[model samples]
Target: MAGYTVIDFETTGLSPRYGDRIVEIGVVKVSHEGEVYDAWSTLVNPQRDVGASRIHGITAKDVLTAPTFDDVAPALLDAVAGRIVAAHNASFDMRFLAAELERVGYVVGERTPPSVCTMRWSGAFLPGSSRRLRDCCASAGIEIVGEHSALADAFATAQLLASYLDRCGGRPMWGDEISAARAFRWPAPRPAAHTLTYKVRADRQPERADGWLDRIVARMPRSADSRVDSYLAVLEMAMLDGYLSLHEQDQLVEAAQSSVLSRPQVLALHAEYLHAMAAVALEDGILTADERSELDRAAACLGLAQHDVDDALAGAAGDDGADGLVISGISLTVGDRVTFTGEMRMERSVWEARARAVGLQPAGLARSTKLLVAADPDSLSGKASKARSYGVPIVDEAAFAKLMDRLEASAD
Candidate 1:
């Protein structure tokens, strides 16, 4: 893989599945001998909110007039064509790029050039050591500029890859092990069948609607405290779940108009909510005119002296429709069978309640079952293994949390 493309993307949020867009991208081309050839980077107008600006430090102002993803799609496709695309977290980057390319009419499937994930490779080869890009680069003495910037990260990744290759005698493949290595696939082993059972109790209740608000209030610094905490919480949760029906928007706007000191805060929160809702609608590929009108109304409210709200609206409106963030939640109903496997620290009753909230059936991995919740899907003798063997979809705790986050975000 000498002639490879080292690529990185700074995205609006995590996960391409949930509606997060790529705001910036960078690529460095290298030859088989580990010689640098060319480099390219671009700021993309993702057309959506930057979300956690503190994390990435990218704002709408940074990409106000930048080229849209469509503008750079062709050149990007050309740069990586017929070359192995490599990155630290290759799957995350590849999935977002592939989805974006697909939106622009590019075909990407099994025949596409093979891409390698340094993160995965490092885990396999350098187990028990820090495998993060920054840590690895520091160990290899690779110079990195502009850490969060796409181009800089790509350059750093290229250097790391080169260092690894040099240590291996400048060969992409291991000597005699090449043949066996060719068949290697990470995330190895299919799932197997297993049984799991948990019981539901009446004490279990769905989380209160104000749970998020309470957390935000508890975490907020004193200086940032706003007496409108309760209102803000509901609005934020509503936005996250895409729960702002057209009628709801009108009612919210009317309520804001009726309020005195609370009007600005309420309108601003509502504006942010609508911006998120519009993004979800766009991702679902089905925003009706009425929904668009509601979004417009929310945007108009933001123009009423809320600069932050306006910034968020601008970001949402410019999104490229390839954001990867996913928000999910659990909604359990009767007769939904689910299986729990492996050792869990929590009480069996607690686990059963969680399954019920998500409408899962608490049972073993039978053909009649719906889903399986495993403590360690990779465990050799756990239910995860059995579920895999039987081709059942097994979700780990973290994966399930992420799913819920995506579900919640989309619901907004």
Candidate 2:
């Protein structure tokens, strides 16, 4: 038996062949006896937009001030050097690992280092179990508190490797691979200038980092004209999934700068937008859990506090009524063309039929497509990527339902 370094990487996308980069890396060292030794993880600044954030929960903002891959490469190499490297799906992790290492000028001799793929070996150990990390962990009764974060997944993989070792009964299932790893020599690591700006995912942090909204506000002048509809329209589209992506933030900032909207004007518009969402959430004389969640997301993106939602709900109840079901920028109408991507909770045919019921054309994704309703709004599928490139608004299933509700309400 040999010690192992279990690794996991959260990348910008699936393949490095498509120009995707790594945004985070986690490593866990375990002793030959399958005892946990050390665990480490860091958010890497990919220096590009974080792709498929919905899948990994890593946002561009999360890595904005973090160390770049080059900055962390030496530390990462030190962790895996002279150890039997392992991962759940070792091939996928190795692909990105090799790419990143090569980019940073670290070579592992003439061949890729031997790796133990827990997923590939799952059938041998946990027979009849699925290969997904979460699924396999569940089968082994190993709890993975964080599914997508790099460190959490790496630690889980380490435990999974330990389970496989326990099943080996003093023998090594991957003895040949371990022997090969012992002979594998890693390139000398280049020293990196240490940076003090590491960041955990927002949910784990006590305070949310000042994000896109704050940056845009800081750039705004004091007393410009209140031509806010243009900016507000862009804001509506940006927050369709209740997540203001980096690309969408760029769009909003451009709109604000172009229209010369002042700091006070933009702040006022955000307040109004929050109030409008609160009003709609209260339209039925009750705030459902879903509506409350939607309002919270809107407030967070708009840089408003939760108390703002409470205040807005109070003010809305005092008013005669809400004008209509307002969900910021969503306003689907008759003859509007909408499309969908990824798997929806409802059947594709069913959602298309519902779209057609409200006089919307359930069409294929194209530049002319008015909206793209995705199961995961940050979907990395071809259609979703194309829609983002084409500047099409992408919303999740719930937001699509809200759009349908608004359309049906208008008809009524």
- Return the top candidate by TM-score: 2
lDDT per residue as tens, model 2, 1-412? 3478999988876556556799988889987778876887888999889976765778778898888888888888888887889987675677678878888777755465668878656655765454467767887889998777898999999998888888887476665578778877777788667643555666552233444333222222111111243355346435635777655555565556654665665666676666666665665688878778777777877778899988878877876543222233345769988998888899999999988887999989988888888886545578976785576767778768866976888888
Model 2 quality (TM-score): 0.49
Off by over 4 Å in 1: 110-113, 123-128, 174-412
Count of backbone collisions in candidate 1? 54
Candidate 2 residue 84 C-alpha distance from true site, Å? 0.6
The ten-residue window of minimal lDDT in model 2 covers 217-226
Instruction: Tell how far residue 321 is off in model 1, in angstroms.
Output: 43
What tens digits encode model 1's per-residue C-alpha lDDT throughout 159-266? 877766776577653221233224423221122233211111122222334333232222221101112222333233234333355544553443333222255445
